[model samples]
Target: MNPIDRISRRINTLIQLPENKEVIFITDLRKEYRQDLKNFIFGETLAVKDGKIVIGKNLYKRWLQKIKTKGFDYDVKFI
Candidate 1:
């Protein structure tokens, strides 16, 4: 799958955890690159508590910025 699709899938899986549960995970968004080398990079974990979602990395900030620039409002939170 594409990078965006992979990321989306990962996010979806992460959000499926119970409210008090912590998700310790890893991912590889890259299918293949540079002489067929698989770039299986580590991804951040996430947790949900008290109706709020917390992300361990600022990567999702870019998506938030895009939404803001487009004058759209979304309910997304990342720690």
Candidate 2:
């Protein structure tokens, strides 16, 4: 599979699953990762809302953050 699918599946596997959910609260994340998640991941079909996965944060807030940190390093993941 491709990198996006690989990353998404890896993250999904880390979840408790079948009951418990996996939520990524981006409040504590650095500005760079947030922007990539908001722009690259969330902005694309890589993110689906049909599962027990939720990246908590408003789209507007994410956009504001991206603008605030414009030109920062992108293509980052939550390491």
Using TM-score, give the best candidate's number.
2
The local distance difference test score of model 1 is 0.36
Residue-wise lDDT of candidate 1 within 26-64, one digit each (tens)? 222121211111111124345655554454334334433
Best-matching candidate per lDDT: 2
Report, for every candidate in turn, its global Cα lDDT versus the true structure: 0.36, 0.46
Q: What is the C-alpha RMSD of each candidate to the true structure, in Å?
A: 13.0, 11.4
Tell me how far candidate 1 lies from the true structure as C-alpha RMSD in angstroms: 13.0
Query: Which 10 successive residues of model 1 have the least lDDT summed?
Result: 31-40
For candidate 2, lDDT tens digit of each residue in 1-69?
788887566445333231243345443344544555555345433343555234543443454455356
